[model samples]
Target: MPSAGIPGWSVIIPAYNEARRLPAYLDEVVAYFEGLDRSYEVLVVDDGSSDGTATHVLEAQAGHPAVTLHRLAVNHGKGFAVRAGMLAARGELRLMADADGATPIGELKRLEAAILAGADIAVGSRALRDPSVTRQVRLHRKLSGEVFNFLVRRLGLPDVADTQCGFKLFRAEVATVLFGELETIGFGFDVELLLLAQRRGYRVTEVAVNWADQPGSKVTVFRDGPHMVRQILAARRRLARRPSASS
Candidate 1:
């Protein structure tokens, strides 16, 4: 439930040089939320984009007052941008969405249902095979994602099928706790977040959602895959040093 004057949902978009790709998604998000009766906000966290990303967001804000822009001083990783937005959001439910809009904003209903049902965190998964869920992914990207998820399962978070998916919804307090303790500031941050959630006994539900591989993606498997793997290993070591809530 949202406090008085506070929005029920906050969509957090972490953008880095996404001027060419973000506008359409922003419009889609605004349109979807406008149809609903509940109050909502869109927080676009510009990750020091040299492009006109911030300017575009400002222009959108002129039209839609619910659209807010949070500019980062320097180009940090996606994890850092999302953490900043999550911490700054005023909504009861915070949704972290990719700027490229791989998953349609309409799919938010599925994650929201999971959260309303009982989950503290609702992760949108592309790997889950649900008759109602559809995924159109490239072969290479799909293969790489499978291999990476296998590594993730071996490391930890075995229950989560798609740990790298950027679409995830978190309850207000859950977002604060998980992101406040976040250390992996790169692409592999999702693995660490799930690990921390598991350690703290948060109810995380994986929901199958419709996803499509969009053009102009920031991640290149061949280039960033190894770096993400290293980050995951580093996060494991860091968590190993920390005591769990039960401990």
Candidate 2:
């Protein structure tokens, strides 16, 4: 079990048509956090999954009380689901991770410790060096990641290595403020959120984390890749036209 102190955390998992995997993933999340000293709650955001994803989550509630379900009647993007969950969460620390379990929820300590040390936001990064470097990503995905990171660096964001990592934790104050400024509902949500955080002058820290590639991936590489690039450019224009925090 992944144990931590009392009043531990509020975890959010956003799912879109994940009926096949939500059953087991939710179980692992709840069971792993069972014996912790922390009082935690898990909110499953069913992002308009038509294939009985909400039904499965509701059925599982028969066994787990700490888990709650929030259904968005329409399919909103990942960012919208996460923003809704985080804003509703009442924990001292708010966490929004993926339903895929690519990054184990247990390793949240890396981010938690960063927040405890005064960072407002702490995000996971598989892009950093480690023994599992090669296993972190496949060739094509890795190539796409490098290109995106290069552009992000060129646009003035050098501290963030992996903006798309599913694992991230934020203090309540930070979550409330940043989630308010979020507009993108798609794949580029992280990039905009990070850029907005920088605009707001929040101390966002990136922590390297353990990762295991899982199947049933949702990102459409070819389609979303171009769309993400557009988002980055749009974000740049938004920042340039809007007043920055330091300004």
Candidate 3:
């Protein structure tokens, strides 16, 4: 139960086989807002982890009622897990962050401030010149990420950099609308969600945030890259066939 005070934010973390990381992430989030006067909820979508991730969450529930756990019966992709959590959140602002906490939870105030400034969506961007974090990632990962972004730009979501950043905040209303219409169930689902928001006349702002690449990520370089390319092409074609927001 939350404090009987104000309606606050929801942080949804979609986790899959991340038992090692979930405890630390939960602790960090809990400690980050320990003194804040607002309410904050953390939803962990355990996408069918065989590594006992859900059990760990359940065990941790003795002290953290604000932390909720949603278990998927099987291993769905990150997109599916995130969709489940966002749609289930009950806050004015809903944020889906990585389970590994790559982007520090402390920077959430910027995203919340963006929402207060009338932005419908706020996403983290590693491509910005001044970032809050700059270590822990392998150079090859950065190179491949740039290559993917170059290809993704061809789909016409301009002025948007680093679509792959796992930390993002959205107005709950906008999140409901966009996540409801999302079709992709994989990593490229982030791109699809952004494309849908852009088409709906939503004001999306990219905030330059600190990001530390965490080890033990589920993404495999060779396998996920080709699949992401296919998803981008599919998203482009789908958006091309639909009418724009003004229509």
Which candidate do you rate higher for lDDT, 1 or 3? Answer: 1
Query: For residues 44-118, could you state the per-residue lDDT of candidate 2 as single tens digits?
Result: 999999999998888877677667899999997898899999888777898988998888777787889899898
On a 0 to 100 scale, what is the lDDT of residue 216 in model 2?
84
Report lDDT (Cα) of residue 221, candidate 1: 91
10 residues in a row with least lDDT, candidate 1: 1-10
Query: Global lDDT of each model?
Result: 0.92, 0.83, 0.84
Candidate 1 lDDT score relative to the true structure: 0.92
Question: Cα RMSDs of all predictions?
Answer: 1.9, 2.8, 1.9
* Candidate 1 lDDT by residue in tens digits, 53-141: 99999999988989999999799899989999999998999999999999999999999999999999999999999999888999999
lDDT ranking, high to low:
1, 3, 2
In terms of TM-score, the best-performing candidate is: 1
Error of 2 at 93 (Å): 0.7
What residue pairs are clashing in model 2? none
User: On a 0 to 100 scale, what is the lDDT of residue 218 in model 2?
Assistant: 84
Q: What TM-score number comes out for model 3?
A: 0.94
